[model samples]
Each structure stands twice: as C-alpha cells, then as structure tokens.
Target: MRGGVRVERQLRRLRWKLTAMFTAVTVGCLLTLAAVTATLDRRAEERALDADLSTRTAAVALTACFDPAVGRITVDDDSADSLVLGRPYLVVVVDWSRDPAGAVVYPARAPLGPPDLGALRGLRPRVGPGDRPVLTDLAGPSGGWRAAVVAVPGEGPVNAGMVVLVGDPAPVREANAELTRRLLTGCVVLAQLAAVGGYWLARFSMRPVVQALTRQEQFLAEAAHELRTPLAALLLVARGGLAHPARRVDAMRDTVRLADRLGHLVTSLLTRARLQAGTQRVDLVSMRLDQLVEQVVEDLPGADAVAVRAAPTVVAGDPDLLAQAVRNLTENALRHGRPAAGAAPVEVTVRDGLVEVRDHGPGPHRVGHGSAGTGIGLSIVRWVAELHGGEFMLVEAPDGGALATLRLPGAAARPTRA
Candidate 1:
C-alpha cells in the first residue's frame, strides 16, 4: 500500500512538470505573435497619418502659388481655407524672401499661438525617391506633431517660399495605445486557455503510464501470494523428513512434486511478464495444429485417462506459443475432469484450426483438485491466441462440465503425395 502511494505521488509530480513546460512554450509563442502584430499595426497607422498631412499641405501650397494678388501672398481661396480652417492641425506659409524670421499667412486667429518659426526654418525637408515631401515629427508645447514642409518652385512675388503644415499626432498615438491594450488582454486570455489545455493534454498522455504501473503492482502482489503456500509446504515436508527416518522416502517424493509445482508456477509467471512487456515476439510458421494438440496430450501425466480425436488441420502460428497454449488447456482439463463415480475421460478435439477440450467434471465455477494454480496459464493461452489473430473462450458445457476452445486462423492443408 505504501509503495502504491509513493508511485501515485511520483506520477503527480511528473504530470505537473509536463504541464508547466507545455504552458511556458504556449505562452512564449503567443507573446511573440502579439508583439509582431502590434508593431505592424503601429507602422500602418503612422503611414496613414503622414499621408493625410502631406495631402493637406500640398493643397494649401497649390492655392497660394496661383493667388492673383502680387507684391504680397494671400491664401484667401475656398480650397485653401477648407484645408486649414477648424482642422486639428496648423498651417503656416513662411516667406524667407520677405522676412527671414518666417511669416505665418493662413489662420488669422491662432488658437495654440504661432508655431516656433526658428524650429520650422531649421528643419531639412526630406525628399522621397519620387521627389515627394516626407512628413517629419516635431516636439511642440501642446503635444507631438507631424509636419510636412513643401518649398514653392517659382520665384514670384505672390508665391511663398515654404509652406509648413503641422498636424497633431494625438489621435494616432491614442489608437496605437488602444491597440496595445487589446493585444495585451487577448494575450492574457489566450495564455490562460493554453495553460488549461496543456494540463488536460498532460493528463491524457499519462493515462497509459498509470495503467501499466498499476498492472505491474498487481502482478507482483499476485505472484507473491501464489508462491507462499507451496513454499510453506515444501519447507514442512523437509522438516518432517529429518524428524522421521521411516517416512523419508515418501517425504522425498512429495518434496519433488511440490518443487516441480513451484517451478511450473514460476515459469508461468515469467511467461506472462514477457508477453505483457512485449519482450517476446511471436515467430509465425505454417504448422499442423492437430499434431501440436496430440503432442501436448501425449505428454500429460494421465494420458491414458484422456481421449484425442484430431484431423489434418494446419495453421500459421508461433509453434512454441501454440504448443504452450495447447499444453495448458490439456493440463487444466485433466486436473478438473474427474467425477466421484469415474465418468468419461477428458475429450480433446482438433478440427479446422480449432482445438476443443471438454472435461466431464465440475464446471468452471466449482473448485476442484489443483485449482490452486494461478489463472496465469489461461491468460497466457488467451495472449497466444490473440497474438496469432485468434481467440480463446471457456464456457460451461450443457453436459455439466467446462468446455475450453482455442481457435486460430486456418492455413491451406499440405498436399498429400500420390
């Protein structure tokens, strides 16, 4: 019982470790994906804002260039007013030729006051590959702003040399902030879900391991229980032989039988272990099933009390396993087939890849002589039959006895010589 508890604790620890590893990997992947998505979204928003600022600046500059007034530039057209009036940005036309300190032409009423002219004039206009004006970000008193600076080409009295358009970037920053918040929330939720899924997957994977361990523990307990009685009897017989010299011969004979029984029990346990652990491989060959059953019957201790009727039936199977299976069936029948009045002998039949053993004794539910043997023998028979793609079954016969059948897939019977 303590061993079982220790195994359970160990299995729990291993399960938790596997869950932790799986959760960590899942969260790492989710965080990486979120980071990449946030970055791409920020770049997309910046591009859009830059494009809007550039388009407004170009419209204002074009209107100022074609103004009818001369000796002084005035942007009084509807198009220029529409681009700058009541907008979330500032537009200033600087006349370097008129006043080197810079001049603001549009927006007669300044809300945030005039922008810093020295800073505006100091900025170097970025030209793209197509000679398009690229917007630049500037730090302002109120907040950060994106500015597009465009220079008028022709030298005329009406044309302002520089058109500076500045737009507040608060909206873009707010949008990016919101996007970041949503991505973080989504990542947290996904991480929780991943942890749950990982734990479930770990438990699912450990089921087979748990079952195998349980089976091993049960096998050990059964083996110990089965060995205890025979070992005690053998020891008692040896002690009695030493105490009484007259009964030494009988004691010696009984000792041999008990030792043989123990040996057989141990061998059966080992065979079961090998079959369960998959250490034993079935070697398939074409062989005569009837001959195998006959050989098994002939080797039994009470061969005279058993009757065999076999046909020329062939099957493809592992010869060793099949022989062991047949031998176990015959032995089990002989041990349990005796009635009080001495009924018919145990009947063994082989027909069309099937071996049938019918005992005219008590049924399977009743305990009889030699019933102390562990049921491992039947388990081995079942395993061998299954390995050869066949089956084994034990059923109560209608004639008040037990009938055991071993069925295998039939192979073509060998050709007889003329």
Candidate 2:
C-alpha cells in the first residue's frame, strides 16, 4: 500500500511537471508572436500618420500665396478650414522671413490649446528625395504633435514662407494602446487554454504507465505469495528428514518432487516475465499443430494415461509457446481430472486447429481444488492462445468433468502426399 501511494505521488508530480513545461512553451511562443505583431502594427500606424500629415501639408501649401508688395503670406481661410475641420490638426502659415511667427488660419480656436509658437519658429521647411514634406515630432506643453512643413512656391518676406500643418498624435497613441491591450488580453486567454490542455494531455499520457506499474505490483505480490508456501514446505521437509532416520528415503523422494515443482514454477515465472518484457520474441512459423501436441504428450510423466486423438492440423504460431500451452493443459488435466486412483484416462484431441483436453474429474469448480501451485500455467496458456489469435476456454464436459479447449488460427492447406 505504501509503495502504491508513493508511485501515485511520483506520477502526479511528473504529470504536473509535464503540464508546466507545455504551458511555459506555449505561453512563450504566444508572447513572441504578440510582440512581433505589435511592432508591425505600430510601424504601420506611424507610416499612415506620416502619409496623412504630408498630404494635408501639401494641400495647405497650395492655398497660400506670397505677396511681395505686402511682404506677407496669405492663405485661403475657407479652403484651409475645410481641410482642418473634423480633424485633430491645426493649420499654420509660418513666415520664417518675419520674427519666426505664423498665423493659425484654421479652427479659429485650438481644441488642444494653441500651438507652440517658440517650437514652430525652429521649424525648417525641408523636402525629402521625392520632394515630399519632411515631417517632424514636436514636444509641447499641450501634448505630442506631428508636423509637416511645405514651402510656398513664390517668395515673399525674408526667409520666404512655409505652410506648417501641426497634428495632435493622441488618436494614434490611443489606437496603439488599444491594440496592445487586446494583444495582452488574447495572450492571457490563450495561455489559460494552453494550461488546461497541457494538464489534460499529461494525464492522458500517464494512464498507461500507471496501469503497467499497478500490474507489476500485483504480479510481484502474487509471485511472492506463491513462492512462500513451497519454500516453507521444503524447509519443513528438510528438518523432518534430519530428525527421523527411518523416513529419510521417503523424505528425499518427496524433496526431489518438490524441487521439480519449484523448478517448473521458476521456469513458468521466467517465461511470463520474458514474454511481458518483450525480451523473448514469439517467432511465428507454419507447423503441424497435431505433431506439436503429440510431442508434448510423449514428454509427460505418464504419457500412456493421456490418450491423444490428433489429425493433420496445421497452424501459424510460435512452436515453443504452442507446445508449452499444450503441455500445461495436458498436465493440468492429468493432475486434476481423475476422481479416483483408477479413473478414465485424460483424453487430448487435436482437430481443425483446436486442442481439446477432457478429464473425467468433477468439473470446472473442482479443477484446481487441491492444487499446490498457483494457476499461472492456465494464464500462460491463455496468453499464448491470444498471441496466436486464438482463445482458451474451460467449460463443463457434456457427460462429466471439465473440458479445456485451445483454438488457434489455421494455416493454409498443404499439398497432400501423392
């Protein structure tokens, strides 16, 4: 019980570790993807903002006229106002030729307060490679601003004049912030789903390991139980032979029999272990099932007491395993089938890829009534039959006793002798 609890605890720990690993990997990947996506989106938004600023600056520049006679730059108020309306920008015509001051022609009143005139005077109307207005970021007491400066075509006062379109970048900033929030929210949701899926997958993967461990524990406990009785009996028999000189011969004979039984039990255990561990491969081959059965019967202790009626039954199977299964069945019948000392002989019949062992014993209930060994032989037989795509069954005989049947898949028919 303590071992089982320990195993369960270890399994639980392993499952949690696996789940954590899966969740961590998933979350890491999601965070990377979200970061990349946010970066791309921010760049796209900035590019769009710059494009709009340049277009608006060009439109404002077109409306401005430089009058050298008045030594001042004039802009069409209606056209500039129409462009600035419903937009988060203020249009200003800067006369660099003057005291670096300009007139704000649009919006009559600024929503985010007036423009920073000190900063505006520092602006230079520069064009890029394609004569595109150079946009610049301006810091002001009100907030952040993006400005595009385009020079009017004609000259007026000293330093000429330039159309400066100042835009409030609050909307762009808010949009980027919103996108970040959504990305974070999506990441959180996906991380939770990944954790849940990881846990479920861990549990699913550990199921088979748990079952195999449980089966191994059961097998070990049963094997120990089976070994204890015979070991005790052998020890007691050895002590009895030492104490009684007259029964020494009989005790020695009994010791030999017990040793043989122990040897058989050990062999059976080894075979089962090898089969389970896959160290011993079941090599399938075409062979005569009847011949195998006849060979097993001839090797038994009392071969004459086991009468065999076999036909030319051929099957595809591991010859060694099939022979062992037949031997186990015949031995089980010989040991448990007889009700009295002089009862009917155990009968083994092989026909049509089937081996039927019938005994004149009581029935299925009494088959292992007085047996000293654990019934692992029958289990071996069952395993072999299943491995060969066959079945093993123990049912009451029609007349009396028990009928044990081993059915195997038949091989293709062979050519008969001419």
Please name the candidate that would achieve the greatest lDDT relative to the true structure: 2
Assess candidate 1 and give its lDDT: 0.76
- TM-score to native of every candidate shown: 0.85, 0.88
Question: What value does the lDDT take at residue 141 in candidate 1?
Answer: 78
List of clashing residue pairs for candidate 1: none
Q: Residue 354's C-alpha lDDT in candidate 1? A: 81
Question: Tens digits of per-residue lDDT for model 2 on 1-418?
Answer: 9989998999999999999999999999998998898888888988898899899888877788777798777788989988888888888787655665445547688665677777776776353223357789887677788888877655423345677788888887788889888999999999999999999999999898987787688668667765777888888898999999898998898898778767877777777777766687889998998999999899877888987888898789999899888888887788777644565559888888888888888788875455545376787888888888888888888777888888887622321110
Model 2, clash count? 1
CA lDDT, every model vs. true structure: 0.76, 0.79
Which segments of candidate 2 are over 4 A away from where they belong? 125-130, 153-159, 340-345, 360-372, 398-400, 411-418
Candidate 2 residue-wise lDDT at 136: 90
